[model samples]
Target: MMQQHGQHGQRDGVDAAELAAELAAELPADPVVPRVEAASVAVNLLWCVPGDVGGSEEYLVRQLLGLGEQASDFVPTLYVVKSFIETHPALAKLYPIEVANLTGVDRRRRVVAEHTWLRRRTQHAELVHHGGGTTPAVGTRPIVLTIHDLQYLTHPGYHSKLKLQYLRRTMPRSVHRASVIATPTDWVRRTVIEEFDVAPDRVVVVPHGVEADIGVEAPSEFELRSVYGLGSGRVIVFPAITHPHKGHEFLLDVMAQHWDDPDLRLVLLGGKGLADQRVAAKIAELHLERRVIRPGRVPSSHRDGLLQLAHAMVFPSEYEGFGAPVVEAMSLDTPVIAADQPAVSEVIGDAGLVLPRDPEAWADALDIVADQRVELIAAGRRRVTEFTAAKSGAALAEAYRLALS
Candidate 1:
């Protein structure tokens, strides 16, 4: 818990200022900031948009902290440079480096990232070299970016045009300005190299870590199923946000082909997106209403319950930087059936069943899974153990060291 201090002289155990000071005092050490003469290795995670965590962007923040903590252990003061440091004065102390003036620079950055001068406007270079001095740059120190995916640049329709335009401009600039570039998957690394035209050597591939916020005591399988109005039967789970690129339509098509079996059920856990209305209409049109369930946006905690309830997790998507749900389900001893997409395949490897991206493949897959539930669940849990946080964080730390050295 944090203590707060207001200007009115009121002091509370949770005052924001006390919280900031506490953060400043309680961090692990590193030497990266100290080794660089007069310089600070500040990381730029300002764009870690909300809702990115616990789903796909989990690794980005954790690795930043993990790498930053490691760097601080050797470097000295490693402030977690942010624009909103004032909002949580307690968190401001988290940044041993320095916060940059992140205001109004979006337009300026857009120009540089897109037009491509690769100019010597390397003001951030000195900031890194000067211990962040009195004032931060237009961005934070070390200027590192965790490129989760290049969906906007590659597949524009996945998001809005404005966001795509923003990514179109800011990403290249961020890439160019970034002293270090990290990605969650090898496919994303390659994509960055090809799309941003960066040297393949500069982009670092660090696989994403799973949610470590689970208990050692596995929950009751029977109770878990009952929570979702399900019974001890074969379950194929697809936990994805409802989006077109997510291949929800294809997943539904797959389910429709096999919705008749009393032994099987397709449970979808995601929020309604642009395609939800149509997907619902299609369900009604196809008359398969009772066969599937869309309970919407299951929290990470509740997700554990879902996995315990599920016999198998099916990742039906067109692409991703990393399929978080697949690994998450695996961690809970849930077997997986991830589509053979590049990112998905890279993460799941041989741990789970890899099916082709064909729309109708679920029928055959479900039929096989119906009979082999126990073995599938066991194998899935075994696979998830490979993606432990220590392993993932260590790999990320190595990438940070390589970037700095």
Candidate 2:
């Protein structure tokens, strides 16, 4: 019985020994390790402006919308003020938004609120894009600022004393603080580098894109007459706010010279600006009430209709970051007679007539454009293809990638 028990114990020991050997062979040589993954980076866009703010504001909004449609390596979050969000409810659904309930009562308060918000809420962001032409003076996040133009500095007379002072005090610091700056044209890019004393490589020139579906459809003469109180005349559309630098007075002068032409009419389409009363006074002094029409801020469809039916688009702005109307007109195959500013010249290329701001030169160019309408229209239509949203979006995406790297 003792011998039998010893044999059974020995068999049990052999089985245990085999099980231990199998476990040792199946086990890894080193301790088990965990797989680590990189956290995704996020980009924050700052666009805070009232709904009524004009072209530059509109440009920024469109840019944000286009960016949202694009596929980026990093996630994007738009930080909009409460008022803007309230006005644009669709914005909340369109992008990931972090609303800043700011009271933009005055410039000082607005600036303070923006700075505070940036400091507190932007820690998680790898980069911040300031779409409103200004950046927080104090922030650690890498910033990409879009300075539309140095017009406040260049044409100080066009801006209020308070606004001019504010820009002078803030613009330089903002430019310096930015990791990269974006401008709408090469002219603006060069100007920013020279004026702000920024490095050339730090600035990128991103031209504004033309809407893909912007085309001309003629409005019925009767409908135009009924709605805007206009007769069947050769319509010249001037799409600009009544700013002093917009050269409205110069256009008015040209119109005055041709006021006696019964078949001619001038249509002005935009919101009133600071110099609106001045323009009204000039219109009264020139006795152009009968010849001029002010359809303030028409809808996009109506504006397109005006452009479609107009004989020409007269844009005589003395300064521009980018000539949006010029491109819009070009895209619609409408002949453009623009001022010979650097940005305007670059945008017009060989498509439209770029003339001096002098009324006589503009008049002659207008006549020339009327004579060469077909050729000019063809040229403009071809040139507009260079400024599509796809092209601009791709450029901006690359710029963002560069900023991140």
Candidate 3:
């Protein structure tokens, strides 16, 4: 475990003062105060709005945490908005966090600040890592951009006109500017290279890593019952937001038509999205209002508790860069039954039931999930071992080296 000190401190056993001096020696003389010294990597997190970008937010945080814990040639310092510190207090303790003075919630303001303010802060860094899909028009040179997905291109209708236009304009520029492109899965990596006409060598796949914090306490049974009303029956969790491509309506139909058990309850545990009304209408139309629980974004501990208590996790999303929830469920010993989407199937890798998006097939998978619980859970545990934080950190370090080379 990385030792923590109040606010700013040594990380991964590296002395803060000594590390700073080493970085200073490597960089050219700069007039900026605190004497600007480049960390090996400066992570640009100005685009991340808390709770807004879905799993990608958690994915980035976990990767940073992993990098801190593992041995690496490059060091990372997070340049974030104040809200990021508020959202993830643990990171403040573990990393050398440089909080920007802007509120990241305003997209226009964020974009402006990224180009004008962030450029100065990152001037000395060897490379700037853009965690968000779109990079700023002006950022430090030698960029390593992480494009979570080409969802905006694939599902244009899902995004707003302004966001679509912005992404359409910026994505190409960002890709062309990036020294190396990093994607969470090969599915997304291949799509990026093909769509942008970039060389395969320019893109690298750094899969999402799962490292459960055993020390972090999960909510108790009483808390689950009192808070979410989840103790009446067997719980199947689908933790995706109510987006159209998430296949909530399809899952609802399967539950209404095929799964006849009154005791089986499906918990929808994310914030509302574009498909909220349709999902509500479907629940009402199928008279499943009583069977489906929509808690609509709970605390992380509560989410952990729900997943731990769930009989299984069912990820019916039609698309994903990487089905993190599937890996998360496995890490928590919960069996998984996910849609056979390319990225999801690649992540699952025969560990759990990866079925087609047909109602009957999902129904059959859910039926067998219980009977094969022991074996499935064991396989899931084994599968999860492949995507550890240490391994992810190593891959990221290699990517950083490639960016410099």
Candidate 4:
């Protein structure tokens, strides 16, 4: 009787094991989850002041927007100020923006926030892209620093004593801390490497690119003329603020040379700058009030319409990390006559007339604009295509990747 009972128990145990095996076969295997490899990049624009940084501000904004639309390797988050959001509401919507509780116009407060608040907020980020050309005293992640130009070092007189002191104190240290330095042109890249004593490999030339649809939504020439109170003269637009380095005085002098042509006009098309009083004095000295127009920062459409209607665009700035306006003029199909600075020459690349900063040289270049108008327009159109936002975005993303690697 005992042997029979043991045999029945063994059969029952075998049946239970078979039932468990059947249940296991009916159930789904554990799903394999793909690992996410994209890194998080915190773009620090804590130093950006709307309508203040000028071309540098435009460059950074375009690059960020380009990256959002074109690159997918990493996620980018913008750390900006309230003014940035207010000025760039459309851009603000595209990113995960973290606004600092302070204003960007104050340098001391910005520096404090950068060292303390910014560090804590960016603790989880794999990389920090410092767009302001300097890194925080205490960085929490590897930095991809964009040094627009070593202008503070090269042209010390252009900056205030306090700013020079701040730049001198921070630039070298930031260079040392940055894993990679991005420059808009090879000229700037070489300058940064030589000035900072960093490895050449550490500095990358990420060329600045223009928006493809530049001047697309421009107002009509008639409307723009009436709004700016401009007359029926052949306009020569120099789309830069009234700054000393921008050669506004020189351009004014050039216009004075062409005063014989009473029908010619020169439009100084940007906001006021440090050299405002000096420029006004120069204009008055040259007696070009009738011939020159200072619109003091017009809207994009107005600026574009002026560009479209202009006989030519003259960029006579003494220094530029990248001659963005040269390309901007090109994109708008306007003939460019630029100063023969290294970056400007590099950007012009036989696409437009390059000349010395002398007033006589510029005056002569202006004379030939009508003759070379078609050729210049064609060359410019071709050259502008090479500097698209996609290329810029891809180059910047690669720079970020290099910093990570």
lDDT of each: 0.56, 0.69, 0.78, 0.78
Task: State residue 357's C-alpha deviation in candidate 1, in Å.
Answer: 2.4
TM-score of the candidate numbered 1?
0.70
Q: All predictions: root-mean-square deviation over Cα? A: 10.9, 21.3, 8.9, 19.7
lDDT tens string, model 4, 129-234?
A: 9987778767766889998877766677876555556567667888999999999999999888888788999999888888878898999888877877678878
**TM-score per candidate, in order?**
0.70, 0.84, 0.89, 0.88
**How well is each residue in 1-405 modelled by candidate 1, as lDDT tens digits?**
000000122222232233334443333332232234443343333322223222443554444344434433323233322433443343344444443333212323212221221112223333331111011124334544566676655566655544445445445656776666777788988888888789877777777666465534555667656767665666767887666777777877777665566656677887665578878888788776776777777555666777766767888778777877887787777778878889888887766778887856666776576677678777766777766665566666665566567
Candidate 2 clash pair list: none
RMSD of 4: 19.7
User: Cα miss at 319, model 2 (Å)?
Assistant: 0.8
Off by over 4 Å in 4: 1-39
Model 2 per-residue lDDT tens digits across residues 1-405: 000011111222222224344443432243332221221222333334553445665565556555555786644566765676775565467566666554333333344445555445565567777766766566655778877788776777765454555567667877888888888899999989889788898899767886577654546556776688778778889998887788889888888874457668889999777678989999899988888899888877788878877789999889888878998888877899988999989988999899887777765765787899999999998898888765665666666776777
lDDT of 3 by residue, 189-252 (tens): 9999999999999999877887658315787867786787665788889998888889999999
Model 3 TM: 0.89
Between candidates 1 and 4, the lDDT winner: 4
Best-fitting candidate, scored by lDDT:
3
